[model samples]
Target: MRTNTGRLSTRRLWALSAAVLAGVGGAFASVTTGETKATTRADHFLQARAAPTTAMPPTATASVTTESPATTAGRPVVSPVLPFNAKLTSSDIPVRGGGVRSGACSGSLIAPEWIITAGHCFHDINGAWVGGKPRYHMTVTVGKLKDGDPGGHTAQVVDVRQSPVNDLAVAKLSTAIDDVVPLTLPDKAPEVGQRLRFAGWGSTSATVVAPSDHLKRGEFSVAKIAPTTLEALPVVPRTVENSPCADDSGSPYFVSGDNRTGNLVAIENSGPPCPQPGREIIARVDILTDWIRTQTGDTAR
Candidate 1:
């Protein structure tokens, strides 16, 4: 099944008519007397049954500037241009024909053998949660700014752990990736109007739904800081030119005070189409810091 933006992968076009796993309702499903049943809304990338009334925000215009020979500047350039290689986080889900899915969301290395991603990414084809033998297989690729880049570390998931309340999950890798430095988890939650960076291998165009094999990064201004989530507005071209889109679930959001160092702040959960005017909900890492430490055996307090 194809969407207006573009053709969707077979793995992505699932029916909501069938019984599916749990998901967050855009506007928390309301309940009334004698009716406790709540309907679920498809998380990010899932085709929307309801057409969005609001159109996406207009792309901002800016004067392009050149960067030093060593460092590139302005907007999230596609991979190999301004490689986000230092952090070592990347989009991990593989697609058919033996390649990583474009716009397949993202995850970060919290430890040499552990990756943190959005909980929704862990669900099965039917959108049902799975364990032990996951209905779907997942592979984590590190040190790869572009999908075709060589010498990167790739590991299959050996185990998975998901949160009970929020949309967060930890995956244990079959092998350790020691060369790439793991990202540091922040101890505090982000505040409103703060600048943050989010990168992924998702779709880059505002209207297109296809994913680019190259890594792309973008900046966002935090608008709301909830206990478990943060809603942000895209500030692309500042650090990136793209917004997260289909298969961009499980992407990492970072808080970089020094602009060189990043602290894992949240996991990309759901949002409207890329470059669209909608709340990009990110799963806050600070609230789940303790849980993450416990799950990954990172006991540092």
Candidate 2:
């Protein structure tokens, strides 16, 4: 779908393309409620889009860099281009083809076995999402920089949890990830206009073109919209620009300001093309501290 700015909305574009998986007899189903319920075959399908009437605060800060023209092009493209040989490890997520699969999104290590990622990344074919339970098939891989293939270390996802209403998700690995040090979450919210860094193995460029299989990274500055403006637009927190594209949906948005600390503030939710003019809203993890603690049974604060 095209946005007011004339660019294709990545989130909507991916959702529509993903529907093809269902057409091939995949068990994909749209989720309506937050609670788990019985699954049934869908008679029709509605592409996921930005829900209207949701409110957001204006001028919030992000921990990444701003977008550039070159980075916004269609196709799988990496930005602030990293060295071709730069070594980085990524978690591996396998999904069933045809319909949306139950595989959760790949994430980066934040602690010994803790990985950070977007909450929406975890899902099943029917979209009846599940988390905070050991039953979820969450997994983490390290020492590999390529997508799909786990280069070095791999571990089973032991537990998955998220903050209520926040886009952040943390997964505990069954075993410790050696060699790679864990990234840290920000203790405080980012200031307005803070530059941030984002990395993932999802589609490198927009979804209009073919998705990329190689790991891609980009930089995006946080753009905050007035809560009134957000409410007026009736924008859902999940659907906003400067967010993740199709496959990058579950990647984490990390801090890249003067503070060298790699604190996480947002997870890719939805958005238009890279660096598009619009408020890229993320589920504010800082605001949902208590809920996160309750779900994980950990004293995060």
Candidate 3:
């Protein structure tokens, strides 16, 4: 598995190497390679800095990389958490083949139509994988905090399913969604240092590309937890920046301690250029919780 293409400056972040790691935002975004054709536009981007690769082992690959759209470098939560605040937000289904929706990528809400994100944000733009059973649609906004904020609650995916190993996926919305509430997965996982808790809407700037509708959060710890994948690292030190950026790719890494606490484990995948600091990776939802309960059969509480 080897495919590499680069552009991502004006907002064309696309980089998939070995097995996983698509850029743009939720799978990142932005695409317009050769033929001199360029019209990709989607604000919430992410992607840059993948880290794992021993020649690609771990079943085959599944290193989890794809980031480059939306927004997420942290900073905004003045008082978030209100209506169904399990945190959710995603966008990238503009379809045209390659992708380019710019911003939106941050989810959590285990079962209620399943949420989970980051299968390269459902591919597109040449990377393929657009979300089974679909006519090109990916929207998951719920109780939003900014970006138009009217009470939140959008949903319209249908199906996605991706995680034979890691960068994980779940989609399947278009129905449930009323009061949020779903996050609670971690039966075992997350240790290295513990102290997680990261939400997202993305874009706080680690280089520029801005895209934050609000719904932000910070706090990092778990330095490394391999098994499927995990990174964290950022208790606030790297010159005061925090971590997780570039549309925060499928964001949702929580487990505040106190005995399970918020639970959830990890989701976002790809980091390092955000707000300056580093280490973010994230993907191990407690070993995928029985592969997300056989793909959203929901039971692994």
Candidate 4:
């Protein structure tokens, strides 16, 4: 299937239909009944690029650029760009043998040249993640607190490497981003009830599905810990006010309160539309810590 930004291909349509049947496109399902069901929308690239009808406000201030460093979770916080926005220009993929086109999703910067995101973000038109070359091109923007913030970096994704054990992937940028601090990997998986904070550029609400122009964060608690996934329930602003929405896949979940220096326990994997109150499913990064370090050639111990 050709992946150029033209009309959607039949195979792409079929893959999306298959995801809906497989319960993967829950990002588009609705539960406004005011009744919380165990809903988790693991969107596999279902993009409806609406205008920024409701972009969530930035959670952190221009702290990255402050004259004096502040602290959170007991560590000095440098607002350098760690999390980022990955903008895609491909068809909405349900699974990248050519899916996961998701027009945009949050990404975690672990190395100056490497970024880890949900594996679903890259694939062929057939929904297969045949790593190395991506069917479509992608651009990454970081360092900026919000769109138009001049203090950041931008790069084109030149290559990609997908995970075999989890819903994760690491993309190689055209150039190194040595100025910003990268988020640290975890030494162990998170425990149930552990508190975490996450930020993203995904939609603010289900109804406002456009990816945000800035990063918005909220608090959540680890409800269940699995080998490859962590189920978390939002708590900070309550469920409906803030949480992952469409195009939020691959955003980071900081174990320490200080996101800048904290250990990334998880990455936004899938969730029902924004503020679902139901647990939002995130992919475990602990499972791929070594894999990530190896990918970036960062062997420091």
Candidate 5:
């Protein structure tokens, strides 16, 4: 499935422009001089985009590109803080190898020790397989506002449960977090054209990484497309197109207007790659309440 990187903030747009110009010029020369080597580099780039760097155990063998520390310092946090809400941080859930190495989806805290994310984000990395047992190897960080580094608390996944068809996963944290308040889930499906806010530690601009692991949040009108429209998209499992990209996987998609009464509608899933514009697909949280309650032992209305 295509991963959806959120739109860039104005400040980030300027920084990305400068970086792209400088890097693209150098990359062009390298591509021309060594086409074979360029292919390998391209492959690595695509692989990073497809799988989370930290999806596997430390012993697992996989090739990953490491960015320079200098570049890391310049990256900005993408989402702005709302009056009563805290943006979800990337550090809350650092992918094993750091950044986009983990599949690029976002997640949200539903209970003290339970987080909700997309099932597809925990799918097979090879993309050759269809359905099977769900994997919980991806690391989840909560309450962080920055990327790579979790501000304070961190937790490893104890278990993961996925819904049969929808892209939903409920994960148990190693320990309960006391500081970060868990968000609530609604019993009803979201309305068409309802304004919603999606928060994550994902890429700021389409293709480029935002500097900090800080939580980034954005507003999107829930363009309720027909389920048939989603079925027509070229997605895996022949399903929807409401997922997040880059660092957004496993992030929360929440309603914004009512603040205290807002409901979490979906978990970040997948979307089109950077430079390609598309809608994000999220695993509908309300649809799978029974499954979630059974797995996480949380009451779902």
Candidate 6:
């Protein structure tokens, strides 16, 4: 599969996107050829739009493209500040043989010690999926209202595993996060036209290129569903401003429930520039429920 990269005014969102898309707000965070974090909390469901009628083939590439170091695109954190947000990034995500990569990313806690994110977040210099250790120093921060907020749990990422079928990946944290409840994985697939919610860390819009520390949560409707991916359009505001931006990779898309908890179904991958443009191409997680269970110790119902 071949992936193409896009450029922005200031920051480049995501990494190596074949132009498809979901997650917390990522797998969208564009690494400045550089780096990329954020979360998803669904508290409300707003109005939605009809699904796109066009038939789209599955793209092998998952997110936008990772370009540099601290300038990655895509936003992750999206909220007033709560748990469940797994902000992802590495000082240098090592590629096998040689070279290193760094960037911002977002994810959702699936278990006491596990977080799920975009597989492309751990790719090699050549864009091939990488496994085993991630981040020369991988750190996951939860519940940070602002970028520099210290009021959250930070854990060490020990192991990284990529899916063979889709753009999903799981990380094993050194310590278990006992405070926040992990997002749920539903067995049912998301229907087209369904309105789902998301919260990711990102710049407010394409024009607002600087990464924000605050979580940006909003609602969107599913446009189309594929075997392993889906497309969504911004629905809450139903404008380009409400759409997911370029940086956050692995931000979650979920069905919101009571008390901020939600169902994990898909993650942010890639698409056009934020605040406007094409539908988002996201990786579907529902298809891999069983495998994620096995990898993360079967999250209790």
Model number with the top TM-score = 4
- RMSD versus native structure for model 5: 15.1
lDDT of 6: 0.59
Write the number of the candidate with greater TM-score, choosing between 2 and 6: 6
Predicted candidate 2, C-alpha RMSD: 15.1
- TM-score for candidate 2, please give it: 0.53
lDDT of 1 by residue, 1-301 (tens): 0113343332221112111115533212211212111111123333332243243222221111222222225322222322223221223232323332212446777788888776655554454444444433455665667666544555667787876446667788777766555678888778898887777765555455444577777788898775466777887532224666655666778866554346888877665444546667777788678878898888867
lDDT of 2 by residue, 1-301 (tens): 1111123222221111223323523222222322212111111011222222233222231111122212123422222222111111222222233321122243566665566665555544453334655433444544445544423455666677743333356666666643444455556655566665665544334434222355555556655532110100112232223234444544556664432235665555444344343434443445444444455454655
How far is 104's C-alpha from truth in model 2 (Å)? 6.0
Off by over 4 Å in 4: 1-102, 237-241, 257-259
lDDT of 3 by residue, 1-301 (tens): 0001222545232222323322223332222223222112122332322322223223221121222223234321212352333333333333233433333456766767777877666665444545575434445665556755544555567788776555667778766753445677777766889887777666565445444656677788887665566766778764212345655577777764442226678877665444555566667877668767877785544
**Model 3 stretches with alpha carbons more than 4 Å out:** 1-7, 12-115, 119-121, 132-159, 162-168, 171-196, 199-242, 245-248, 259-273, 276-295, 299-301
lDDT of 4 by residue, 40-85 (tens): 2333353334222233324342112322223455433334544443
List TM-score per model, in order: 0.66, 0.53, 0.29, 0.70, 0.57, 0.68
Better model by TM-score: candidate 4 vs candidate 5: 4
- The per-residue C-alpha lDDT of model 6 at residue 231 equals 78
- Runs of candidate 5 exceeding 4 Å displacement: 1-46, 49-104, 128-137, 147-151, 208-212, 225-244, 257-261, 275-277
TM-score of 5: 0.57
Model 5 Cα lDDT, one tens digit per residue, 20-116: 3244421111112111110111121124433454433443322121223222245422212322122222221233355444233456677777777
Clash number for each model: 12, 20, 38, 19, 46, 80
